[model samples]
Target: MIEFTNWDILRNLLLAARWTIALSLTAFIGGTIVGLLLTAMRLSGRRPLQWLVRGYVELFQGTPLLMQLFLVFFGLSLLGFDISAWAAAAFALTFFTSAFLTEIWRGCIDTLPRGQWEASRCLGLNFKQTLSRVILPQAVRVALAPTVGFSVQVVKGTALASIIGFVELTKAGTMLNNATFEPFKIFAMVALIYFALCYPLSLASQRLEKKFNGSR
Candidate 1:
């Protein structure tokens, strides 16, 4: 085994942490876009569209994220897709994030007073107009806090990407541990780094919740 200084291990882990953050951002942004489309479909009140989006959300949310990663990373390869660990992780996590985001946003929209929809209708506004002008503006306030909160989950979820050979922070930790045989110390640092990454988002989510709730 090669000798590694503590600084070497930390420095390498920190470099890998960049990929973790990058992956989280890629997944979150992609998920948000897909989720908005899904949310729109769910709100369209078409039975076929609603059922389709529902199945999508259920398929992602009902299953384990690990299994999803495995399928995307390995299963796609079996089908001759030649997907890389990075692409597979990004694709799987985006789907995973989008599913939860769809539910979160749908719940937000549902919480709005029913009269809002009716009032918009009475004003001669169609479904699209009502959604853009009335429903979404209001639902956004309710959704912001929870949406930020969900980002913490997204960050934590990136750890599972390591299982698919993605060289993220967790994967780096495993590699360093294997090299140095210092599981306890290496993982303790991993946990600390994750906490550092996630704690501020957690705190922000709470603060936003309080801020929005107070305004409500």
Candidate 2:
């Protein structure tokens, strides 16, 4: 058994936390890009495009994220691609984030008054112009709070990445526990680290929601 000093345990956990942050950021950014595209497609007003986007969203949203990670990591290997744990985790989480984000933005868009759309069209604006100049601007206010809140979920989701051999906080905690036989101490620290990271975002989300709602 290895004897890890308290400082040593904390230092190692802190190092592992960096990867969790990195993975969350990567997933959020990538998911935003993909979610925007999917949102656009869903809003395109063509039946086929709507159907396609719905199917894509449902597929990701309906399945377990852990299962998705498994498929991305091992399934790609079956197809002869050398998929690393980092790459697979990022890919899976990106799609997972995108699906939820697209839905969130869609709900925001739906909340807009119909007159806004009609006015934009009356001004001879095309769909793209109307969306960019009017609809999205309003929708963004509604989307911002929820988007920030969902990021906490993404951060928590990173724990599962450790299962596929991506060594982040949870994996680090397990290793430390095994080495030191200090499950309570090590896992408590792990939980504390995650709460420290997530609580601020949660507070920000609530603040934004209140601020926006007050203005309206």
Q: How many residue pairs clash in each candidate at the backbone level? A: 0, 0
Compared with the true structure, the alpha-carbon lDDT of candidate 2 equals 0.95
Q: Rate the local accuracy (lDDT) of all candidates.
A: 0.96, 0.95
Per-residue lDDT of candidate 1, residues 1-216 (tens digit): 789999999999999999999999999999999999999999999999999999999999999999999998989999999999999999999999999999999999998999999999999999999999999988899999999999999999999999989999999999999999999999999999999999999999999888899475
Quote model 2's TM-score.
Answer: 0.98
List of clashing residue pairs for candidate 1 = none
Error at 123, model 1, angstroms: 0.4
Q: Residue 143 deviation, candidate 2, in Å?
A: 0.5
Give TM-scores for every candidate, taking all chains together and pairing residue i with residue i.
0.98, 0.98
CA lDDT of 141 in candidate 1?
90
